[model samples]
Target chain A: MKQGAVDAVIRGLKAAGVSVVCYLPDSLFKELYPALDADPDIRTIPVTNEGEGAAICGGVFLSGKRAALVMENSGLRASIEPLARMGLGAGIPVIMLMSYRGDLGENNWWAIPHGITMEPLLNAMRIPYRVVRKEDEIETAIHDAYEWAYAAYYHVAIALSGEIVR
Target chain B: MNRFDCMEVLSAQLKDELVILSLGGSVDEWYNAAPHMRKASLFQQQLGCVTPQAFGLAVGLPHRRIVSLDTDGGMLFNLGILATLGNEQPENLFVVVWDNECYQSIGGPPTHTAAQRVDIAAIARGSGVKEAHVATDLATFEEHCRKGLAAREPYIVVAKVTSTVRRDIRRKHSDGREDKYIFVRHVEETENIVIMGPSEHN
Candidate 1:
């Protein structure tokens, strides 16, 4: 991931009033972790898995603060249960910032399914999402996700692609 | 002792601490034990998320104590939360796993804790929870609960209990959405922070 892109995402999270971030690290968004940790305004919790991260974000929401879950697209599959229980079932919103793997121009064969299953899963869960293929859309999409999630009281996903994760 | 007995003793030790109960029997029993504590009690319908949710609340509200009333079946579903809770090491968090060793709510199906004899406290310690204890009786359970609530470090207390159903276990006070609003409002009032706001369109 580009340093500039990471900075932009962080700025957007801060702008969205995200006081805490729970993430499961992936190679695609490796750079974002340290930057998130370094930020004084946001408390970052590196979780064991995406489901745990999702639940933590739900917990943050319950405590009257906004939180984002950062993970790889594959983690979306791992996090469906918590997302459904907390976000869909209970009406608590968890904004997710995921890196797009197995996307266009991808080299890894194992990563292909992640891209294939990401959208369908989000749709099945009725989670509105935006896939950011351009660097400029990164910040706005994240900000929009938070705004929409708060209003809708549901989970939202922002998939980072193109120059941002390249 | 049964789950209700454990909750009955434990509820007396609680103050204004936030509570997250696992799905099924824990929710009903806790509600019966402490109806007035509903504002602080988040009845988690999601199995396996009790501790994780409490961990998030603990991190978000660092100044307040967060208690997770969990069960063996639910804990088995997301055992990794033990490692996460251990790693995060929130000082104000305490987890109480009601180990009846079975999926008591749905049916009397034996879980790993009962059939295979899984020691949850050992797993907690191995997962990095420094203070983990298993209590087989009410006295030990209450003692551990009191210590865990008062301690500055995170603690996991597994109370060995019987799968005895209470006859007067009533329905929860509110549905999920209502519970959320009420709980959030309670947090706002107690913590003096504005969480939910009126609709802008209204």
Candidate 2:
């Protein structure tokens, strides 16, 4: 499930024609970064923070390009400002790939509160999201997320779990 | 060096071509005091990204001057931008680091910026800015700034300013996002916005 989830996410991004990705080095998505970095088809911008990454994606979108940001759920908190202010204001779509940190028998106690609050926070921001519990749902989630992004002109996040942890 | 006086010189010299990326807090005084100065962007204290963002603007536009008006406190957040700027080698960038020895934007909190003892200009010299200068006050600052711009190099000018914040001056005038969009659009719509060159550097 480990490499499988990675492959599915990469395939989904390629299928959607995502050309650039913004990321802040996160342990959860370490495996995916190098692959995308080396791929000549895509441009990867390593940002200092999640909010900056999100804002850069907004910029990429305004320039008429497709973009996605990879981050752990903790990165979600830092992104709220840019997500709400610019992304929502300009009707830019963002595909957020998040690693579920503190959910379903997770050990890290500190990540628990944020993990619990993540979905609700997205709801509060009115940014649509989905949880992809299995590798099979990856493509559908990404495709639907892109559609939602275009229709709503807002951010759409997908959480990978069960299979991701493997 | 008089901060206001140096700003006046810079404004008179480079206002036509460059947009300074200002930081939040007390540095607003120099920017606000000199309305004659050229237009600038992203003045809010978003910390550390302004330089890179300016570099990004420089790359995308490739036809305008991109100046980052940074505070030491803010610059410390992501110094890596220096290496990246040098690596990318965008010729249009001018990073002006205002080191007043405190986080004057947020109630003058001490932000061990550059370790106080470290000569930030020397650090910039080592960081590949290619042309970095440290000016103690307005006169020297104005002089160095002119030379840096005149040399046609990616420059870093570290101004050692006095720790001063005008309570009346606003900390932030534009939301970071709005500035980004407007400036980005400004670069895009106009193919050639840089009106002046090193010849005009005061």
Instruction: Please name the candidate that would achieve the greatest DockQ relative to the true structure.
Output: 1
Query: How many clashing residue pairs appear in each of the predictions shown?
Result: 0, 4
Model 2, B64-182: lDDT tens digits are 66666776765676566665555556677777887877776566767775366766677666777778888886777877777766555688888887775556654445555565455
Could you give the interface RMSD of candidate 1 in angstroms? 1.0
Interface RMSD values for the candidates, listed in order?
1.0, 8.7
TM-score of each: 0.97, 0.69
Model 1: colliding residue pairs: none
The TM-score that candidate 1 achieves is 0.97
lDDT of 1 by residue, A76-151 (tens): 9999998898876678888999999988888999999998999999999999999998887888998889878878
Question: How does chain A of candidate 1 score by TM-score against the true chain A?
Answer: 0.97
